[model samples]
Target: MALRLAQILPPVVLLVLAIVGILLVVLPARETTKTPENMYGIVLDAGSSHTAMYIYKWPSDKQNGTGIVTQHSECKVKGRGISSYAGIRGEAAKSLEACMQEALSQIPKSRQAQTILCLGATAGMRLLDIVNSTESRRVMKEVETKLRSYPFKFKEAVILSGQAEGAYGWVTVNYLLENFVRYGFVGKWLNSGRETIGALDLGGASTQITFETAEKVEDESNLKELKLYGQTYKLYTQSFLCYGQDQFLRKLLAHLIKTQGVKSPIFHPCYPRQFNTTIKLGQDVFNSPCTKSYRPAKFDPYMNVTVVGTGDGGECLASVKKMFSFDNCTYSKCSFDGVFQPTVKGGFMAFSAFYINYNYLTRLTNISIRSSNQMANAMRLVCNMSMTEMVEKTNQMERYLKNVCAVSHFVKILLTEGYVFDEDAFPTISFQKKAGGASVGWALGYMLTMSNLVPAESLGLMKAMPSGTWTAILTLFILLLFFALGYMLLIYRARTKQDLV
Candidate 1:
């Protein structure tokens, strides 16, 4: 009876130890695995025409040292850009109130304090700074104060340089297109092997061209070197101030007034026929620094000047051509106005006013512009359309409709003539307003850069035990289970042998 009891007790104890060892290894592993919370960020794009706030989010456990950011929500500020509130002491800051409140609602209170908030003023503020440095500083200070009132981790409110703007825009384009990095089938972020494309941004007061190039950059200022996802890129970028659609139109009007001697009933070749309007000499035509060169020597600052349109598409193209200087090429190549540029390479994404103008052209002509000739045809069709016909067909406001022809010609000339996107390369330029559910702009790129400042939580710290310790313990438990089974098998074989005896 004593021998039987000893044999049964030995097997029972071994089985109990095996079960205990298994629980020790499995229970903590389950406890250690957990899904991380989502993180949020905000970027306010204070462009020339308006201010727009974009909210983005990513998993706290970032991918490959960078956050996988995606647009969560956006709010357009109610008023014009902050620069328009230059003289009004606090108005610029007040302009951001509605959008700031919207951001508050979009992100939870728990995360608001940690969420980064930044405001980057583009060409509008840059222009204001160029014109009035004191006023620009005051406006930026007011905006900074207003942002600090919120719970967010306010970073900065400053005017972005044209170079920074162009570079950030390029980053936004490539990031959204997944040219920088992409999720692989193995569930890891990997560098995308695809070639990067160029970025063409046509704002109200500035136009920028940026693209990766292997050619030597003669002008050091036009060259920008950027590193992303462990890959480095050498880019050539140029920002033309006072050459945007709005500013170019101002320059054109100022030019006509200068050449035509500021007479009432002045003829404008770009405007549709029978479209006449009265504008103040100082405010409308020569108010901008862009037209400072064309400002008349002696004229009433508020003199009313009447202008009439002839709707001559040929004349419009010819006049637009006069605005750019194709002569000077100090470098190996030049785009226009003496700016150095390497040959435009790869595909291009045109956005902002470019996309808007392209949309209008397509809607008006019902044709896709694949080449310069096709673009010229579309421009002529829209140029000849009378105000009534344009308003009826486009269902657009009169103010916006009148400038369509002039702006369209400006864009056409700016692309083919100014930037020199030839027939073969023209088709590669895609007019896009949004990509990856986010508006195609520099703001996302700015946020992606800021995300690098955020530190990622360590996986080992999140787990119940260190990975090495866990592995060692798991191995020990697995081996113990095998040893217990082996012992039980040996006892069973001995019992069978004894029964045979």
Candidate 2:
């Protein structure tokens, strides 16, 4: 009885437990430490016309926590975003390799980076084109292989989606506003009687509108409520899509004729402003002398009749007046109705006349199109304006969307559905860009945040390990433990026999 039990006991308890403990560390926590400083993180913000690369370090002391990350030091390289549309293959690899080398120069040589994470945006995610049809099942494979060719032991990259970018922007904006906005810390928006606000972010290819109010997230439970201005929008509400200035314009021109019921105009050699005119059927019909440029052989019926023009440019503004001429027409004025009319609020005209009553889209569209050009131009317009002026412009834009566009209704819908997701209810801002300029502020902020959270060594372990290997490990341990016990038992039996003899 003792021998039989002994044969099974060691394998069942000690061996099994030992094997499990090893697996707990090996399977669940397969994290391996990589060299510090040598772990390089590359963020490729691939826009339509340009690509920007930002490099970061994985610090040894980083830890996970709440609150906004502040450090942003990183090396940046141009020529990677939308311009590298052919998926990161061939020439793409060469270009990125050069960028990697250049980035290496920015960091200290004493530190070596062991892992590389390359994140691609826009084109890589949305508009990848196949190069040489002979290769892989997916286009991204080409991109993945090329990026992985880097010298680092661990090389991984991801192309972000449109929704992802919008979501990230929403998170970033809220975090920044929470830290800098007035009355932000009091969580006044969470109070039953506090005012609320909205936020909008317009990127090169997409725009996001967020309607937010504060809610009380009890330390004890998972509940929240939002307060918007005097009313509540919800916890958070937002909408993001691919409707942007350049894309909108291109699509508009592509669909003009079928939607308008007019023959396509010839391409006018004159400036865009001079092309605006009142056409007289003139009893002569086909005899009208028109430019050859605007003429399309066929019409597109799917055209969204709403036109969105860049809101910031006096030139763009001039172009709107000259081409569409909505300021003087009676049919186009007095109300925000009509597909062709331009609304006069928010210091600009509404493009999608349908959204005159939709606060989220209207407000976001206005900010997006108005400030659509570039940061420099938008900043210049407000350079001479006092704080009052800036606030007035901002508030006026808000009121215009709220009152004229009837944004409250949509905001209410989002509230009911619980889609509004701002950290707080008000618009808060920090002078990150201004203290050292926006570019430097962005860089420093990235560096500080990356250093505090990521440890370079765990990159490989994170990438490996699928599942279902535990059964094999357990069986192997049981067999080994049984063998060792059998040998010991045999020796004891042999010794007993010898003593008896």
The residue-by-residue lDDT of candidate 1 on 1-501, one tens digit each, is 788778777767867876787675677445336766768999999988899999998767753455556788989998888988888888888889998999998899989988999999999889999999999999999999999999999988879989899999999998888776554422344556899999999998899999999999999999998866556789999899988778888898888888889789889998889999999988787777889999888889788988899998888878888889989789788889888988888999999899999998988888788888898888879999898898888898888888888888888888887778889889999999998777998998888777662223211111122357667866776777787778778888998999999
Candidate 2 residue-wise lDDT, 182-222, digit = tens = 22111111222323323343333333343232433222111
Question: After best superposition, candidate 1 residue 258: deviation in angstroms?
Answer: 0.7
Q: In model 2, how large is the Cα lDDT of residue 255?
A: 31
lDDT at 405, model 1: 81
TM-score for candidate 1, please give it. Answer: 0.83
What range of 10 consecutive residues in model 1 has the weakest lDDT sum?
Answer: 454-463
> Which regions of candidate 1 are displaced past 4 Å?
1-36, 453-501
Q: In model 2, which regions exceed 4 Å deviation?
A: 1-40, 57-59, 63-84, 87-89, 114-116, 127-139, 152-155, 174-199, 210-239, 257-501
| Cα RMSD (angstroms) for every candidate in the order listed | 10.3, 21.3
Error of 2 at 189 (Å): 22
